[model samples]
Target: MNVLIIGGGGFIGSRLATEWLRQHPESKGKITLVDQAFLDIIKNNPGFECIAGDFSDPSLIDPLLEKKPELIFHLAAVVSGEAEKNFDLGMRVNLYGSQHLLEKCRQLAYCPKVVFASSCGIFGGDVNQVLTEETAPKPKSSYGTQKAMVDLLMNDFSRRGFVDARCLRLPTITVRPGKPNAATSSFLSSIIREPLNGKATSYPVAPSSPFWILSPKQVVRNFIHAAKLSAKDIGDDRTINLPGITVSVQEMIDSLEKVTHKGITDHISYEPDAFLQSIVLTWPPNFDTKKADALGFTADKNTTEIITNYIQEEHIQVPEK
Candidate 1:
């Protein structure tokens, strides 16, 4: 299968590239990684090629579609915080960019399986209720609104036989191995990631505020699962909520402490950013994953496993006392 990852340079996108190659070592197919920038790790792979360009530009996506990728993983977007702050950029990249890609897919020689990386941010505002596949989106932020719009477009395109699409409403992926990005949820990873690197990071939300989280490991597995499932197996509903565990800021810090020591935990201090807190608090921290569970998708066991996985995967060095 010729696979194309739209945001193949980002955290989940790059990891997905490695995972795809690992699972399909014997296959004689090309993996194209497209992002504004790329890491040498993926760019250097013999089976893969990297394209650095804006996905929103028709100039970039048109030729890529001509490559006739059998699988398309659309993971690019302006993250929540930045998206909220810059409506035009979010609309351009997240909404119009998605539409452009899907339109290009419609022109493909074959109907490719398009795996969209949606977000839990789609479910915000008055979210005291437990969110489920049946729940409706009441997006409170520009980022959430854009994702929700794309989800609708993806479902419509699939319904119209344009592309075989599966939209996974992903949770807040934690312990992402990199500096913070524009996502309001970046702090979720920073609190653990920075402290382990023996640096200080702030907690923007209340310690008691909960977040639905999945590990980088699980996210990659779920992406593969989403790609491999047949359309009938995935059913008519192309959008499904991915399963994940919930952890509060305090719980995350506690898990970090378990993995390291108080010295690491001491590096983290709560200094609330009201804007971030408002955006994050609007999202429901819990979900009913029965749909995802039935479909054989899974989540991390806990935040402890998440942190440990990050350490091992990134080869993070722990400072000795």
Candidate 2:
């Protein structure tokens, strides 16, 4: 089972590569890790091959299609903030780039199973208190709009028997390691992750601001589960919302306090940024993932568990007294 991860060098993508390699070492198949950066980070791992190229390049798709990987996980994207900032780049990479891949798959005589990593931002607005697979998407950001559009295309392609595709609407993955990126929600992970590591963090949203979240570990598991799911199980929709736990900014701070045992909570101060607030306020706070649950997809049982597991797995050292 040859697997190709389009953005394999990224946080969630890299984790998925590692997990798949660890679990399927004996399987006679190659795992190709493709990303424009972080090739060296994944180079040392056995059974791993790296392809450094831009997914937006039309030329890149032909070579990848020639490889004929049996499984493809399309995770490459410009992310939320960058997408909103660079509209043309966002459309080129997030929307058209995905279409390029799907077109290649459609041209193939033997189609592969494609697992697209979509975002919950597609739901949009605070009024929709609980999002479900049935909810009509109303994306507010270019990034969200692009993901939602690709999701519809995936369904249409699947119905046409071009490929076995499943779109997983991932929540805001929190407690991510490493320095922050362009995502507006990066602060959600940074506030807890950075402070726990004895670093300062800023809260860009109000303490009462609430949003749905999933840990990196849960996100990886959800991706693998999506890949393993049968097309018959997914039906004609071909998209499902992954489960997540919803909590407020204050709740996250309190959880950090409990785990770190330091009044690190004091290190956090709310100074709401209108730009980020506008984007965040439009995101759904919670979801009704009954369909996902029934389909055997799951997230962290609780927010506390999500935080603790991240601290443990990433080996982020606790602050000293």
By TM-score, the best candidate is: 1
Task: Please state the error at residue 217 of candidate 2 in Å.
Answer: 0.6
Tens-digit lDDT track for model 2 on 1-321? Answer: 889999999998999998888888853248887888764657777678877889779787678778888899999999898999899999999999999899989998897999999999887865556788888899989999999999999999999999999999988999888899999788998888888878778988878888889989988988888888899888899889988888998888888888767567667777778888778789988788988999998888777887889889987788875
Screening candidate 1 with a backbone cut-off below 3 angstroms (N, C-alpha, C), the clashing residue pairs are none
Model 2 Cα shift for residue 80 (angstroms): 0.2
- Whole-model Cα lDDT of every candidate shown, in order: 0.90, 0.86
Model 2 worst lDDT run, 10 consecutive residues: 20-29
Q: Cα RMSD to native, each candidate? A: 1.1, 1.2
**Candidate 1, run of 10 with poorest lDDT:** 21-30
TM-scores vs. true structure, each candidate: 0.98, 0.97
As a whole number from 0 to 100, the lDDT of residue 114 in candidate 1 is: 97
lDDT of candidate model 2 versus the reference = 0.86
Error of 1 at 310 (Å): 0.9
